[model samples]
Target: MTDNTNNTPDGIQKFSMNYSERELECTVEKEGNILHLHIDNNINADLEIQQDGSLIQTSGPELPPSNIDFIRKHVLGQDAKGSVVATSGE
Candidate 1:
């Protein structure tokens, strides 16, 4: 949930991890069925875990936006259920 009283157009829903300076601020306009990772504005990557607890990660420059869209659609949507997604690694 977010404090929408200010009426910001960007409307970023934020989540933070322990020991990380940059919090993962996700959008809430789409279905986020996947997790995304990015670094230094040049590298992009994605991750998805199946129902069987399997993990998948995709790497490229174009992955961030797609993953961000997923965060908007699925992660922030109240109709969806899950723990939380994150970005990790160096």
Candidate 2:
């Protein structure tokens, strides 16, 4: 597993995962109580995160099973802050 995290100057936090050579990236931007999740690479989808932590896909193509599972297990519920946080899963 390969993971990378970074923060943009505009306050968006980006987290990427490379597993089995497949890469997926998510850019998280929070405004007030809503969080916008933009997925790229392996999956292309714009998701709106509700205050209750529910994810609603707003746009982009359908995601594969692997991508969906990855988002739920690792990306969802993760807090986005103005700092870098990275990890690798075995």
Candidate 3:
């Protein structure tokens, strides 16, 4: 969980990820039960908690299994006990 002291508006969380070449500042928009990830201006994804306690990406760019799990654990802040749904290729 993030504190309001981070300068983000209430309900919004921000984090940073170290990629191969650069560090990316990530933003998460919480809307109801959905968590919207803004990896950048264009690259984004929406994850929703399913009835079975699974986290499924219902929209946005096709990310890898590792990346999705990374979001689920690091961004969503849980080692999801239920299924962590993957994209088509995964």
Candidate 4:
């Protein structure tokens, strides 16, 4: 079987954050300028790049404004088929 634990497939990447009580894990896949995000393996969202370079959540989980902003700034701009990126918080 292919090892996907460390090596993510093309057009796919992963990120994570840690908290006192829980952890947040996310997977992002890019198709053109559109990003498909899966958060905590439960929340799924689609972030689209607009003509003005703004990011918008087109579908999926109702995330807080701050969460949306975070995804837009950090997750959406990455090259999905490149490498896996991760983040941690305490």
Candidate 5:
């Protein structure tokens, strides 16, 4: 008898973040001049390439707390991504 084994779930890499009581999971993929952000298998955000090399989000009703330098320092380059979360009014 022969045995075969594989440990790849859905054959995809999972990227996610957790903050406060909110959680977000996404798979990053590059497509032409856009970065696709998917959440739970749905298109949630779109990042566009700017003339100055900066990126901007073109969706959602509000912006999320983020640290671009956090990505730059670790990513080892001038790349950025957007995050979203609910906030309370004071």
Candidate 6:
């Protein structure tokens, strides 16, 4: 019998984070200049790239400003597609 495996799409990746002693597992998808953060199988953040290489949360959960900034710095401008800017629980 044939079985259906994980149905993740192309250009998408999954990873986890350690935030304040909490483990946050999620996926990341890159589209245009935005890195979409998915958590619990749902899109959590649509981080928009700014001119200065910073990212702004256009939608999804209202992440704390510090958490947003932390992720922004981790996102390499030239290799954003390969880089992930994970968030924190708090």
Top TM-score prediction, candidate number: 3
Give the alpha carbon lDDT tens digit for every residue of 1-90 in model 2.
Answer: 211121112246677865447665777665443335565634445544443444445555644445544554455434531222122211
Task: Give the per-residue Cα lDDT of candidate 1 at 42.
Answer: 39
Candidate 5 per-residue C-alpha lDDT over 23-44 given as tens digits, one digit per residue, 9 for 90 to 100: 6665645555454555556435
* Winning model by lDDT: 3
Q: Give the TM-score of candidate 1.
A: 0.30
Model 1 lDDT-worst window of ten = 3-12
Candidate 6 residue-wise lDDT, 2-53, digit = tens: 1111112225665565544566675767665676777666537777665545
RMSD of each: 10.4, 11.2, 6.7, 11.0, 12.9, 11.1
Let me know the TM-score candidate 6 reaches against the reference structure.
0.56
| lDDT for model 1 | 0.38
- Model 4 global lDDT (CA atoms, 0 to 1): 0.57
Cα TM-score of candidate 4: 0.60
Where does candidate 6 stray beyond 4 Å? 1-10, 19-21, 73-90
TM-score of 2: 0.42
TM-score of each: 0.30, 0.42, 0.66, 0.60, 0.47, 0.56
Indicate the worst ten consecutive residues by lDDT in candidate 5: 1-10
**lDDT of each model, Cα atoms only?**
0.38, 0.45, 0.63, 0.57, 0.39, 0.53
Q: Which candidate do you rate higher for TM-score, 2 or 4?
A: 4
Question: Could you give me the TM-score of model 3 versus the true structure?
Answer: 0.66
Count of residue pairs whose backbone atoms collide, per candidate? 6, 0, 0, 0, 0, 0
The runs of at least 3 residues in candidate 5 whose Cα sits more than 4 Å from the true structure, single-residue gaps closed, are 1-13, 65-90
- lDDT (tens digit, per residue) of candidate 1 on 2-86: 3221122323234532213444543232113344544444344555543432234443333333443444334434333333334
